[model samples]
Target: MAKTNYQELVFDITRLIPPGRVCSYGAIADYLALGSARMVGWALRNSFIHDGIPAHRVVNSKGELSGRAHFNPPSLMQQLLEAEGVKVENDRVVNFKEVFWHPEELGW
Candidate 1:
């Protein structure tokens, strides 16, 4: 009978990611410990409703821009990342291991 604010929660974590870094859907899901990676993706897919969410900084576990299609022009996701100094090639983040950012960095 109650609605959870998982979407807001996802946004909170996503906002914590600094520029030039990225997190994985599964990583966020694991940090919240409330839903699966798919659920995290769902929240992000509908994130356009809110501004400043920085959803582009989130990628799949493999650093793939799996949610690119959700952007206005699918390439916008990669474009955003690149603008932040995070390189992406072939629909995936370049040097993923280096750009990967963990939510725990916030002491969560």
Candidate 2:
């Protein structure tokens, strides 16, 4: 598959994360098993053109919105996550383990 297709694969899976939930780039990468977590972040960073991605739902392994800078105004990432009832304090999701959703273990 081409690079774009790979990105689409990443997006396709990202779209599946239910509301009030979050997933790490590493989990998505592990589930897809085609790219690394950094690649997932890269794909999401360039995903601005697409709608419904909920890119905000993706964060670093430590539950930090490391990709926040890619969002317009940057704070938008944390805002979106807050809107979903996923609390983010200090740019890190609060109680990350509970809110975390693993695509692999979830049968994605």
Residue-level lDDT tens digits of model 1 in 47-103: 889888999999999999999999999999999999999989999998999989998
Candidate 1 residue runs with Cα over 4 Å from true position: 1-4
TM-scores vs. true structure, each candidate: 0.94, 0.92
Cα lDDT, model 1, residue 64: 100
**Model 2, CA-based lDDT:** 0.89
The clash tally of candidate 1 reads 0
Q: CA shift at 79, candidate 1, in angstroms? A: 0.6
The CA lDDT at 39 in model 1 is: 98
Which runs in model 2 stand beyond 4 Å of their true positions? 1-4
